[model samples]
Target: MATKTRVPQTIDAYLAGVPDPAAKKTLTALRAQLKKLLPKATESISYQMPTFKVDGSAVAGFAFFKHHCGYYPFSGSVVPALAAELDGYVTSKSGVTFPPDQPLPAKLVKKLVQTRLAEIGTRAKKLAAAKKTLITERITDAAVKEATGHDWKAWMRVLDKAGAAGLPHKQLVTLVGRDVESGWWRQSIAVAYEQARGKRVVGETATTGFQVGVVRTLPMTAPQLWTWLTTQPERWLGPGATLNAEVGGSYVAPRRRGNPGVRGEIRVVKPGKRLRMTWQPDGWTKPATLQLTVMPKAKGASLHVHMEKLPDADVREAMRERWSKVLAQAF
Candidate 1:
């Protein structure tokens, strides 16, 4: 029996497999440039093409076709958004096809990808909200069969070959994402394996650390709540903490007494409605995230606080209790 060959698992491997030396050279240069352009983005082979993604959305990609190369600025809007700059290049709303042996201009490529990044700012907020951070609702084997036409045993058999058990949670999710195409279901499959194989357990998320959510209907209107919170955030956030109400505005806060102070930027701000910002109580590791929303009700508004990326259950519980007490007594 013939041994089946393994598919290329990375962008470098995929580029090495390209038959044409000219195309390979061109794309190699393009990849190097893109890495510099999108220093914060992750590079990988997505959809069997060289893709650069940020926040799990494909921001840019490129490939070799039969007669030419194509640059794909994903999210369905980048190419058209810069139609004026793309003149003289054979461009479609989907992607730009170029000469087989030549690459797109580095400056133009920078502008194109950066614009796409800026466009996805508010969209990233929605994506963060939409992402399945944890598998709170367990996915059953019958549900798996319904989604992918395969039962748990059969799915496990396939995952075994890919070494899914050994793969990290992110890689396992990506592997499932390629087949399922839905964010929530992809997480469900990955988490199912984690649970069955002892990789994780209930009340835990592999990516974001422990999470805590608290909601309270304050005896104040939405505008009143926003004004009080933004003007004097130190009361609940921490002493000497400042929350600039403008999106992209900078703020500072003290962490542990001995640790250095840290700075964070507000990500999204809908006046009198919602606010999302980074919370760095430790100022050492990645900062936690805090999302607050106010929804108008009878005489007052409901204030919701969703915090994630806590270090452990202790921190989660501590934060949960703190927020509960603050909201109950302070409001």
Candidate 2:
């Protein structure tokens, strides 16, 4: 008669009790992979399986059965993204199974771990954004008055008298900045004024819009990069390009030969760190926002471009390619 084995209470004990040598080896390799991928995660035995957790949430788990090993991502969506790569394996909504004799490939395991980590990161970002929204929504008239020395009604009247209803989004925000001293109060007032006047405010996405962004590390300091962006854009853009270098200022890149020039209004200007503007090419139906952020690294600086509210997919891709070319030339 065969001896009945007791279920182990800890991850180490569980791995030690696996009777089949091949299964034990496979499990050990997987354990090592998980540990390598998630050095900060906690490992434990949960539900008679080995589980890895981060921030007290389960990110991944695994178990060995008689003939197969199972990989659990703790997410129903994670496996579906890699469906093509998992063609030969058995999969369900939350996990995948591979034969013990044929251990999961190292690359596939790495991809699985990465996907789980990304999912966790995305979830955390959403939660933080939601919390920020909640806090913003809780701001009251008293709070605005205390911060900016003016109540919501007073700010509304000021905006109404200033003809904010007729102004564009960028101009309205600039106007708000000038009227309210505190940055937080300024944003709150602008939102309230827009809501009262039926004007669209920030954080609302257009129905037919997309966003594209790219990052590049340049061999220069952030201040030097800022100078390049502001003073010498014509080197990469083209001759005759001009920038005003202040909020609410206009910029123009003159047409050369047969090409049409670009025009925009600077909406934000933070020295050596960030710049944001509204971009409209000669034939574009609507304007889009372009933001540049610079961060100092160990040796140089990293520049990032984020363009949003593009009208269509084609325009977005075209803009991406154009920016890629521009960066290639600039660097």
TM-score of each: 0.41, 0.42
lDDT per residue (tens digit) for residues 1-331 in model 1: 5443344668888788888889999999999998888788888764346878776656778887667887877544577788898989986555787886667888888998888778667555654553454333345668778887767777777788888988879999999877787798788778777866766744467976678887888898888888888898766655667777798886786653222455677998988888888877543466788888989999799889898776654456445545654574564
lDDT of 1 at 64: 77
For every candidate in turn, the CA RMSD to the true structure comes to 24.1, 19.1
Residue range 1-331, candidate 2, lDDT tens digits:
5433355667788889887888889988999988998899999765447888887767778887766778877665678899998998887655788877788999999998889778778867764665455423567778877877777777778878888887766677789888566776566676666656645423344232477776778899988999999888675556667888799888897764324578999999998899999989888867888998999999889889889978653345445545643664576
Q: lDDT of all predictions, in order shown?
A: 0.73, 0.74
Whole-model alpha-carbon lDDT for candidate 1:
0.73
Candidate 1 C-alpha error for residue 308, in Å: 2.4
- Candidate 1 has what TM-score? 0.41
Overall local distance difference test of candidate 2: 0.74
Which pairs of residues clash in candidate 1, taking residues 3 or more apart in a chain or in different chains? none
The segments of candidate 2 whose C-alpha lies over 4 angstroms from its true place after superposition are: 1-5, 135-331
lDDT for residue 46 in candidate 2, whole number 0-100:
51
Off by over 4 Å in 1: 1-172, 175-199, 206-209, 256-263, 329-331
Clashes of 1: 0
